[model samples]
Target chain A: MATLAAVIASTHHPFYYKASTAPPEERPPFADEWVAKITAFRETLTRARADVLVMVGSDHFHQLWLDNMPQFLVGKAPFYDANWYNEEREFGLPRMLLRGHEELSSHILRGGLDEGFDLAFSNELRIDHSITCPIITLRPEADLPIVPIYTNIFAPPLPRPARFVELGHAIRRLIDTWPSDLRVAVIGTGHLSLELGGPRQFGPHGPDPEFDRKAVEWIASGDIERALAEVTLDSLWTPGNATHGFMDFMLMMGVAGEGAKADYADSLDLFHTMEAYFTWYPNGVPA
Target chain B: MSKYLLNKFLFTVDRDPDLVERYRSAPHETVAWWESTIANEILNCHGGEASTWLTFDDVEREALAGHDYVKLFELGAHPFLTLTLFIAMFERDYEEPLAFQKEYAARLSHFSLPYPDIAT
Candidate 1:
């Protein structure tokens, strides 16, 4: 029974690979700062000795398609490598640590339903950047095995806010039922606000400060359910195609529970269009 | 054709105070702004019954005549507002609309909207 550590979303842009390899000085301040933050965050995870991670992010069209998109899909591979960033860069994952984690997938599928999430399990699926970026960012050493979960937040007819919260509880239940004696961490990626594409794309890289302030206040106070409920497409995301990805942020709150607090948060510039943050669930709380 | 179209349109307007204010203060001008700024591609792809809910008044029709679908959908109050309109449009008969909705989603995912977290 592996323990669940983090439920994070992939906050990297789809063009991150092309962007990241550019010389640091030539990159935008936001991108450069993010790489540093990601590197530091990974070091913290290593220090915490987190043994297993349950990463939650949405896929673009890598594995599931519109014709057969499941609301929830869990990766069941014993050893899966990320296709876009890692493979293209010749970066190697810690394959030895990844060897024996199949049961975690079964446990999540079984437990998720008990908490009311209709999760689909896939063994042969390959992981894309959404799942891979956070892993590589937090654990460049790949010392721990990860259970990747993909949500259909980006497509039309996305799951409602309340349903996403339910999925979080389902993940908690899945972690509690795992047979392993390991500790876990969950990471949720995506924006506090601001959609990445279309006209909303024109200016405003940082999110609406008042909204971000309210969200932080809500999380610090431990009223997670309310925080989740307060988020809507218009208020929390950009108006166009940009709104789809923010659903992953709501799902992260579900996994983090009421007690988790934001360890770090910052809004960046490029139009002040981007935001990045992290939340951690301390060990004392029961899953 | 159904009264639901008007209900859905008004319901959308009522829910978004900003748009309601704009419509009340300057209806024709607001309509023009919507025509120019919205993404018609999204409207054509996901609009479904929303196209009918629109009143197509002479001025609005003239403004929107050559507009793209995505732009038309963007003119609505919010993404969710537009989304719900589509949902309501299909909610009655349900089945066929759902299949269309699914196909529409697949197409959207192809353009990089589906995966926000992956490093490109």
Candidate 2:
């Protein structure tokens, strides 16, 4: 059976790309610092020798719509051709081919259904910043085969916070049962808070660091009960609508298995949002 | 009206990068195209049980009114679209645009039209 090597949760806001072009002082002080942090993070992945990565992200009305939006969708394509337009492309995002692990993806889809998850499955799905940005930032090489899972965080009728945790646990069960030698890693891409298109979409004021700090502390504490009790939808969006993406973070907690502690956590608060990163080792840190 | 045409408009703009660029570069023209080609078709038919043909011209006129974001939101336009249009149309003066859009969201948050029952 394949081993669950690592579980990482990181922020995926367009501001990372937007800030890359801005003057140094205009961008967050920590923005430039991620190059080093991401490089080190990548080193951990390389050390783990992970072959397949399961990425959990949310769509921004890009590929899905309110007409027929799915609460949870899984990408089952053979490859992902990221379609980046002018502005997104200008942010130094390269158009590249990302490999997709079809067999594992199929297993996950089956497992989700068998486990009674009404998941939306697509064989052809477009990659957006939510899935691409983090990979581009952290795993710049873009070599690993991946399976992308998208949740409906933008539209209404969102799945309960607990539902996301269940999905993660289901994924863990599938990985545990798979009869393969592949070393798999799971990534949850989202953020602390920062509204987009809402009234607070653009601003000079920074994200609520107090909210972010508590989130970090909760995730790092390995106390799922406390995390669940505290990080409700109301509390998550205390900063703004975009903070709802923290459901992705909760999903990662479930993927990290029972007692995953934060191997590392970085809170990078940009001008308008908190682009945070957290890594947890499911099988405990390698001595 | 189904009160979801505005939702469709925002979804279209968000999905199509070229359309977003068009709206950003030429707001009046983009809005005109959407009004004539897109919104007209969607808003013309009464979406309720009764077979009533909506007056598309009146809807278009209301949409064309200058800075009519709040009016549209009140008329069943989704808050996401209204705020997006506000920012896209006037983001050059960033802070003010944010304030304007925020006020619109604040107002809509009180009313229950587009986002009915969707706990935010």
Candidate 3:
């Protein structure tokens, strides 16, 4: 059986790559502080010593369109080209090619279908910043083979928060039961309260700081029940138009398990959205 | 309401650098050409399989032609798509980072909770 090395969830802010890498003269004032927090967060994964990563992220209508959108999809290929032209034009993200772990990808796809998820499979997926932001933040080397799982957080008629949680639980179950000697770490990214292309966008803080506060508490404490109780499809709009991305955080909570507190949790309030990072060790802390 | 077509305009143009520039330089002509040529072409499918019923209505066409994001929001076009494409076309005009985005928000400040439905 595979060892679930670490369960990590975070907010994938696209600007982090540019903000952290810009020369001092060109860097934003918040760059140093943001870089420091990300550095410490990166260590959590480093210490886990994961052999492979199961990356969960939402596509921002880059490839998947309303014409054909899937609720949950798994990428089963030997390689995935990351970032899009729009991402480069907007966020200055580097184009990347990530190796795929086809063995585990097949395991999860088969197990997931038997477990009742009509998981969509894509052969050639050009991923956007949702997956790459984490790769940039957590593993700059981008050397590990990954099994990319995309949840439709962008398209409407999206799965409810509860459904996301269920998918997370299923993923955790499948990874734990996979017949393999490799250690796997699962990382997913989401937002707290975001308002993209709306009246409240690019503010000094997230569109709704109050919601961010409670959301961080729910995630860090692994309070799945509380988070699920408060979050609903309709209610998500109140925080910010894009706050539905919070459902991904709920999914990560399900992966971490109910009432299983995080080993490390931290958040930074950036303009437009709150940046959050959390890590959990299911098989105890690695040496 | 052909909200889908409105978003299709934004999505298709946003991805193509040539279309982004074309739309920016000549919104009226670009929207007209797209509606006639590209609007009905089924993405990821062959040209022979193009759909005939995906044309935009007057208001939706005008919104795209005029670059009226305010009207696009009211019509329930996906905000993210609208913003990203708009930023690509207009952000370069601003002196400060996110100035164009902030101005974009200000343009839609009248809208409150329960935003227009973006469901396709």
Candidate 4:
């Protein structure tokens, strides 16, 4: 059986790529601190030495559209082309291609279906920054085979926050039960009190600093009950229009398990959004 | 209220470098041409199998043609779509980083929370 090496969750701040890699003259003043934090966060994954990764992220109307949008979809292909043109245009994210773990993808699809997930599968998926940002941040070599799971955080009539958590729990079960010796890490990224394309956008701090602060506590402490009690589809709008992305973190909390404290947790306060990182070692942290 | 069509205009045009340029420089013409020639075409499908009933309403057409992002947001055309495409077109006009984004926020600052429902 596969080992669940690590369970990780983070905020996928699209600006990090540009902010960290820009020429010294062009770089933002916060870039150094941001890079230092990410480097430390990256070490958590490196220490786990995961062989396969299950990446959870939401599509920003990239491949998935309002027309025929799937609430939850899994990528089960041999190869996945990553990032998109607008990502390059808007965030300076590089185009990427990633290998897929088909056998595990098949297992998850079958197991998820049997578990009543009604999982959507795509043979050819061109992933966007939601999935790629973590790869860039945690595993920049982008060398490991991955199974990409995309949730619909953009469109409305979306799966409620609980559904995302349920799927995460299911994914953890499926990965653990897969008939392979591969060491697997499940990494998911979301936003914290983000207000994109809204009146509060591009502010000095995330639109709702209070919400971001409380959210960090819930995730770091694995307080799923409080998170679920406080978060709802409508309530999410209060923090910021784009705060629905926080549900992805709630999903990661499910993978980490209720009351399962993250072994490694860190955050950086930045403009428009807060950058957060958490990693859990279910089998104890590697020495 | 074809909010879907409104978003489709942003979605399709933003992805194509040529269309982003065309829409940026020639808003009225691009909207008109899109309405007539491309609006009905179903994305990710055979061209002959176009969607015939997806035309934008009068308000949607003008809001897009006039580049009224504020109106588009009011009409629930998906703010992310509106913002991404707008940045692609207009970000270059600003001298400082995020000047356009901050301007965008200020422009819509009058609106309070319990925002317009974005459900399509």
Interface DockQ per candidate: 0.03, 0.26, 0.90, 0.91
Better of 2 and 4 by DockQ: 4
User: Which parts of model 1 are misplaced by more than 4 Å?
Assistant: A1-10, A14-20, A29-32, A84-100, A202-209, A219-221, A233-240, A263-272, A284-287, B1-120
Candidate 4 residue A253 C-alpha distance from true site, Å = 0.6
Q: By the DockQ metric, which is better: model 3 or model 4?
A: 4
Candidates arranged by TM-score, highest first:
3, 4, 2, 1
Residue A264, candidate 2: how far off, in angstroms?
Answer: 1.9
With a 3 Å backbone cut-off (N, CA, C), the pairs that clash in candidate 4 are none
Backbone N/Cα/C clashes per model = 43, 1, 0, 0
Q: Per-residue lDDT of A53-163 in model 4, one digit per residue for the tens?
A: 999999998899876899899999999999999999889999999999999899999999999999888999999999999999999999999999999888999899899
Worst 10 residues of 2 chain B by lDDT: B111-120
Name the lDDT value of residue A111 in candidate 1: 76
State the lDDT of candidate 3 residue by residue for A88-119, as single tens digits: 99999999999999999999999999999999
Q: Write the per-residue lDDT of candidate 1 for residues A19-96, one digit (tens) a residue.
A: 456686656546676666666655546555677777777775445644366888888888775653222422222222
- Residues B75-119 of candidate 4: C-alpha lDDT, one tens digit per residue: 988999999999999999999989999999999998898778788
Give, for candidate 3 chain A, the lowest lDDT window spanning 10 residues: A151-160
lDDT of 2 by residue, A49-112 (tens): 6789998998765566664678999999999987455325334455668999999999999989
Q: Point to the candidate with the largest lDDT.
A: 3
Q: For model 3, how does the per-residue alpha-carbon lDDT over B5-76 read when each residue is reduced to its tens digit?
A: 998889999999999999999999999999999899899897689989888888998989999999999999
| Candidate 4 or 2, higher TM-score | 4
Backbone clashes in model 2: 1
Clashing pairs in 3: none
